[model samples]
Target chain A: DVKVTQSSRYLVKRTGEKVFLECVQDMDHENMFWYRQDPGLGLRLIYFSYDVKMKEKGDIPEGYSVSREKKERFSLILESASTNQTSMYLCASSFHSLNQPQHFGDGTRLSIL
Target chain B: AQSVTQPDIHITVSEGASLELRCNYSYGATPYLFWYVQSPGQGLQLLLKYFSGDTLVQGIKGFEAEFKRSQSSFNLRKPSVHWSDAAEYFCAVDQAGTALIFGKGTTLSVSS
Candidate 1:
């Protein structure tokens, strides 16, 4: 079983505060992703890293950034948190192969006040 | 223009009854389809995926999905429903190893 762990299950922060959400995978998968899950919108990719120091922007990359410094960890950062940015953040990891499925962490529910 | 659509927003089914969730996609070429479920307060879990060769693909937790090329549909079905199966189901489409385009999602409600 693949284990993907998020740093926090729930978070709260004031507007304009910088926020960081972390994820770590145990399977040593080469691909890591960060997404925001919103009602009626499903999951929209924010950023994804194929390898260490390599990152790509997804459809909704505005106002968000990601870092992958090591093989097992991926982090999503919010430069200036806002009320609209409050969402459920999810992290997923997959093997390098395209046909493989992504394993997900439990998710972190972020609230910006 | 690649997109996935799940027409149903919410579904209510009795325990032990058969279940089916509809998923439709629009793409220029061959598409990889997948079904995922998310429990309350949790992330999405892959239920099944359809790549090629086999139109009917089985997945974890006794879920199966069938891909129909003519309709560009990959529908998920289960022989029996359990209470624990109550969750949000999403249908997604992607190219080989690309970012997935997901549907709005369908929420399943189970009755005792």
Candidate 2:
């Protein structure tokens, strides 16, 4: 079975603090994604990387940035955490194709105080 | 740009009852459609996807969705509702590449 592992399941950070959310996939997928899910807003893509060291901005990528140093690992970075950024963050990975389905991590619920 | 819409924000049904969740899409051409489920504090799981072929597609956990080209809708259905099936369901459209546009999602509640 394919597994997408997230570093943290829950996290709390203070305002103005830098935060990192890590995701690792064991399926050797070439595509990794970061998304923030909010109530009523649904899941909005923040960033996605098709290959190592390659990244693309998604619909809502203002306060967020991503790093993909390795094909199996992707990280989401919050330069300065704020209360408004508190939400559920999800990481997903998929084969490098348009028709492939993305496999997701369990998710990390981040709260910025 | 392709978009998805899950009209029902919430739905409630008793155990063993039939279930249906409506989803609509807006795209210039025939786009890839998908349905996913997310339990509380969990990531979304792919329930089913419609790329081509038969309009009706069966998925995991006894869930199925039918794509209606005329209505531009892909509605999920289940013959019998289970308590464990209560979760948030999202409809999504893939224009190209791996990026997916998702709907707000519909929360399903199952009661005894």
Candidate 3:
């Protein structure tokens, strides 16, 4: 089975702090994505990387950025964490195809104070 | 713009009852549709997907969804509901080679 692992399941940070959420996928998939899930907004994509060092903005990309330094690792960075940025973060990886489904991590629930 | 819509925000049904969740989409051409389930505090799980050919697709956990081109809808259905079936369901459409566009989601509640 494919496993997408998030570094932190639960995290707490103060406002204006720089937060880093890490994700690693064992399936060697070429596509990785970062999304923030809110109560009514469902899952809004923050950023997605089709390959290492390549990133593209999604529907909601403000105040957030991502890095794909290696094939297996993808990182989501919060430049300045705020109370509004606190939400459940999900990481997913796919096999670089349109028909392929994305495999998701357990998710990181971040809380900003 | 291409988008996905899940009409029901929440639905409650008794155990052993038939269940159906509605999903509609707006796009220029035939779209790739998918149904995902998220258990409490977990990430989304792929319940089923519709690419082409077959209109009715069977998925894991006794869940299935049908793609109707005329209605532009792909609704999820199950013959019987279980307690463990309570979860949030999301319908998504492919964004023409980019990431998927997901709906707001429907929270399913199963009663005794």
Candidate 4:
């Protein structure tokens, strides 16, 4: 089974703080993704990395960035954590196949105060 | 842009009852479609996927979805629903396996 691990299951941060959310995949898949889920909004992609040091912006990429220093690890960075940025964050990894399903980690529920 | 639409926001059904969740997608070519379920406080779980050939695909937890090219729909269905089946369901479209566009989820509530 493919395991995607999120560093934190629940997080609390102060407004304007720099927040880092880490994700690691055991399968060594080439693609990793960061998504923030909100009520009534489903899940919106924040960023995705197809390979090490390569990143692409998703629909809701404002105020957020990502790092992929290693193939198995992808990091989501909140440049300036705001109250609106607080949400459930999910990380996923998938093989390069066109129809392959993404494996997800247990999400991190972040709260900004 | 590739997009997915889940028409029903929420649905309630009794245990042992047949259940169906509607999902529609808009794409130019043959779209890679998926259905995912999320329990409260948990991440999304892939229920099933539709690529090509077979129109019906069986998924985990006794769930299945059918792909209808004429309707541009991939609707999830189960012969009998259990209380444990209560969760939020999302339909998504993949852009050649690179990016995904998900729909606002449908919340399922199973009664006793």
**1 or 2: which has the higher lDDT?**
2
Shift in Å, residue A60, candidate 2: 0.9
Summarize candidate 1's per-residue lDDT along B27-56 as a digit string, tens digits: 888888889999999888899888889899
The chain A TM-scores for the candidates, taken one by one, are 0.98, 0.98, 0.98, 0.98
What are the models' TM-scores? 0.97, 0.98, 0.98, 0.98
How far out, in Å, is residue A24 in model 1?
A: 0.7
Writing each residue's lDDT as its tens digit, candidate 4 over A1-113 gives 89999999999999999999999999989999999999899899989998999999999999999999999999999999999998999999999879989989999999999
Q: What C-alpha lDDT do the candidate models reach, one value each?
A: 0.92, 0.93, 0.94, 0.94
- Quick one: ranking by DockQ, best first? 4, 2, 3, 1
Q: Which stretches of candidate 4 lie over 4 Å from their true place?
A: none
Query: Model 1's CAPRI class?
Result: medium
How far residue B54's Cα lies from its native spot in candidate 2, in Å, is 0.8
What candidate 3 gets wrong by more than 4 Å, as runs, is: none
True lDDT of residue A79, candidate 4: 93
Docking tier of model 4: it is high
Q: Report the C-alpha lDDT of model 4 over B13-48, residue by residue, as the tens digit.
A: 999999999998999988999999999988889999
Candidate 3, B1-112: lDDT as tens digits: 9888898999999999999999999988779888999999999999999989999999999999999999999999999999999999999998766698899999999999
Clashing pairs in 1: none
Better of 2 and 3 by DockQ: 2
Order of the predicted models by lDDT, top scorer first = 3, 4, 2, 1
